[model samples]
Target chain A: MNQIAETLASEHIHRDEVGAKIGMWLFLFTELILFGGMFLAYAVYRFSYRDYFALASKELDVFIGLINTLILLTSSLTMAMSITALRRGNKKLSLIFLSSTIIFALLFLVNKYFEWSAKFNHGLFPGSNDLLSLPRGEIIYFGLYYVMTGLHAVHVIIGMIILLFMLFYIKSNKVNQDYYIMLENSGLYWHLVDIIWIFLFPLFYLIH
Target chain B: MEHKNNHIVGYGTYIFVWLTLVTLTALTVTVASFDLGGFSIVVALIIASVKALLVMLIFMHLKFDDKIFRIFVAVAFLTLMIFIVLTFSDYSFIR
Candidate 1:
């Protein structure tokens, strides 16, 4: 009787593990579609006013963009390391790496704030501003600019919140070598966010 | 617990991925600075694709996962690209 009960409990845990993995993948698919729409809009506007887009992109601070790119890329490295730690049964190192990933993500956001505010102060916002004094085409370019990067920033915020939750989960012992799906899934989402910025950096800040 | 497979990610792999990403970023920025005419976007997108592969494979561990999951990811991405391209064609060629 005792052996049967133990077997039943183990089976239940295995079922939950599978469920978590599938659930996370489904959530990731939703994110893919969400970002997919924004990419489509960016492509349309960029193609419509290619020259104006190039001119507007030059106004962006490439230095800040480059810095943010490096920051996010570093965060991704830490995130991957965190997952590796979890899989290897090193809970303390996993938590440390996870904390660093969150810190780097926050740094990325702070840099973005300054970059966006600088543009705002310069009157580069949509719907008529001093920065739009160039031409009508450039004005429309700034509009798309705010919309795309603004949306990307929002995603970064969401990713940060998710990472925070995962961190707490680790601390609470909900995640360990036996079960690290949360870390894996969050890592995937974080990587996607980084990949988006990989494209955004050049699109918004590198045109000559 | 049944350990079906154990695939560890080494530190060298991490460094290699990061190097590839930085190199690609530099290339993209340099290409964008030149007057490549219509080829600029093409080159940018190609570089972005390579970066995406590195992240998906190395960071996300898709390379070590089940084949089914990989197939699903590939199909999803291909479908998304096709949809975007078809929609863009409508706007690009229209009067």
Candidate 2:
């Protein structure tokens, strides 16, 4: 009976290690398609309205976008390191790195808030008269801008929530050196979000 | 049972990749400031693709993970490319 019980437990853990990761990757692909659809829309519109897209893109503040990009890239670094720290059995350092990642994520969101607020104050949002009065291309530009970045921001929030749960799991020793698929999966999600911003920063902010 | 997190990356590697990514970000920003016209978007996208590759391989550990993950990523991007191409082919003939 003891032999059978041990076999079952070990087999369960073994299956979970790879199976969980595979499952996470599959989910990430679906997310890619979701964002890819938006990207497709942006592409078609931009191709049709090249000059207007360039003109409208200038309204975005490059400095803010640059800072947010750096923050997200650094957050991704810290997230990757956190998993490494955990795998090395240094729980405290891992926790610190993970916490820093969360902090950076919040900072990115704060920057985004100010940036969007400035646009809103200018009445540049969708359905605003100011936006309506703009050229047709610029109108579509701002529309894609809000939808894409807003969706990315929502993803940032989701990544934070996932990492926060990872913190609790690590603290409880539920996700330790031997079993940390949850932490790794959360890191994957965070990196995916970072990757999305990587494309977004160029398409929206740098095109000007 | 052997753990999946067996291939451990050091702090140095992550830091190195981070520095490269930052430098590339700076490079992309600088490149965009110069009005290279059509080449500007091309250059910016190339740089962005490189950065994304680094993040996926190193930070995301697709480098060390199972082959299936990489295959799935490749397939996903390929599918996205197909959609983009098909849409453009249709749109290009519109006018």
Candidate 3:
């Protein structure tokens, strides 16, 4: 009877890995809808105010936007490689790649800070007198700009935090080769951040 | 318990996908520079979609993951598309 009880206890502690992954995917679906709504709004404004959007987009520095895109893309690669490394039981390489991913996230945020600061110095922010004096289309353009990119920046920070925790988990063996659903989930979140920026970069900076 | 069949993606594959994504980014920027007018946004979006797909399938492991995940994501994206189309249809005609 004791042996049977022990077996049952072991089974109880065994996780449903597939279920965990499905749950993460469900959460990601919701995130998609959240950002999808904003994309719809942006499309409406851009369609209605084509000329103003074009003019407003010109004010954006595409060079900076391009650089940020590359940063995020490279970060996504590192994040993926980290997961692969972990799966292959190469903890050291996984940690290295994960740390690089976090560094890239920081670099992306730093660039964003400078970009926003430059706009602020120009008084192009939402509700600024300079922005208020602009045409309605331009005003809405910058409004969407702030709301979309601002929200995206928030996600970047969140992704960084998630990856930071993942780094520790990997080191602690809580997320080893045999148990890495958590790390994979984090990778999914990070990739989603990159995917969002892929669209955002073109919509805001390259549309002109 | 770990699934014994868990497909492991190689580092080389990740690097290849990364290279493709970077190249596409450059392509989009170059395409945007030509001032294609209304068509420019369309072209840019198409390129961005390709890049996003590469990340989803390769980086996110969707390609090796269970079929259910692929179906779920497809449904989610379809729903978003429907919402966008319905909204645009309403706005496009009124203006």
Candidate 4:
């Protein structure tokens, strides 16, 4: 009876690889749509108050945004390479690449911390006197900047955590060459993070 | 549903994509510094879209993924574009 019960459970478990990926992609689509709505809101606000938005954009440090973009791009490369390493059956190399990816992610968040701190030093927080005293359009611009980038940063953190779990899975031999969809999915999510930043950086920092 | 089809991308390919992405980033930064007026935003967005495409195709392996997966991604982007277009159309007439 116990053997029969185990067989029945295994039969229904059906761990379809492509199906799992399709599900992840569908979830990612929802994420894209969520960010798309925010971007549309940004578009309307910038269109309505062009000059003020431009003025507000100037307050951002292009250098920080540039550095963060490079970091994320590098991280994305490392992430892709990690999967390649795993497929090649080089567990050590894969782990190294994954570690580098996570480090780059941390570096990005560190830069974000300093950037936000500088804004706070100048009293540019959400409800600070500096931000509140600005023109309505400028206020909206900063508001969107904080919310959008903040959300993206949250995603970076989440992606890093996922990579950490993947590392453990690799260490346990659970994500080897023959079965590595977990690692691949994590890489997919990291690339999504990179893609979003590719758009976010220019929209917020380089909108001349 | 081809779960066994795996394409191992080369290190050189990733490096090349990185180079292109870096170059595009530099271009966006340099172009933004100039006084291009309305064209600046459009140029930046176009460059961004290209960078995004490279990442999606290579890093995400969309080029090698299953056909149905690619179809789903295409549908998602199409839906997003329609939403953006509709929003702009409304704003163009209303404002």
Please identify which of the two predictions, 2 or 3, would achieve the higher DockQ against the true structure: 3
Which residue pairs of candidate 3 clash? none
Cα lDDT computed for each candidate against the true fold: 0.81, 0.92, 0.91, 0.92
lDDT string, candidate 3, A110-137, tens digits: 9999999999999988899999999999
Ten-residue stretch with the least lDDT total in model 2 chain B: B1-10
Docking class of 2: high
Best by DockQ: 4
Q: Model 1, stretches more than 4 Å misplaced?
A: A1-19, A131-134, B1-5
lDDT of each residue in A86-141, candidate 4, tens digit only: 99989999999999999999999999999999999999999998899999999999
Poorest 10 consecutive residues by lDDT, candidate 3 chain A: A1-10
The local lDDT score (0 to 100) that residue B5 gets in candidate 4 is 64
Interface RMSD of 4: 0.9
User: What would the TM-score be for candidate 2 when compared with the true structure?
Assistant: 0.95
Q: Chain A structural similarity (TM-score) per candidate?
A: 0.88, 0.94, 0.94, 0.93
Model no. 3, DockQ = 0.82
Please give each candidate's TM-score: 0.90, 0.95, 0.95, 0.95
Give the per-residue lDDT digits (tens) of candidate 1, residues A145-185.
78777878898899999999999999897766756777788
Q: For model 1, what TM-score does chain A reach?
A: 0.88
Give candidate 4 regions above 4 Å deviation. Answer: A1-13
What is the fnat of model 1 with respect to the true interface contacts?
Answer: 0.51
Q: Chain A TM-score, candidate 4?
A: 0.93
Lowest lDDT 10-mer window, candidate 1 chain A? A13-22
TM-score per model (chain B): 0.86, 0.94, 0.94, 0.93
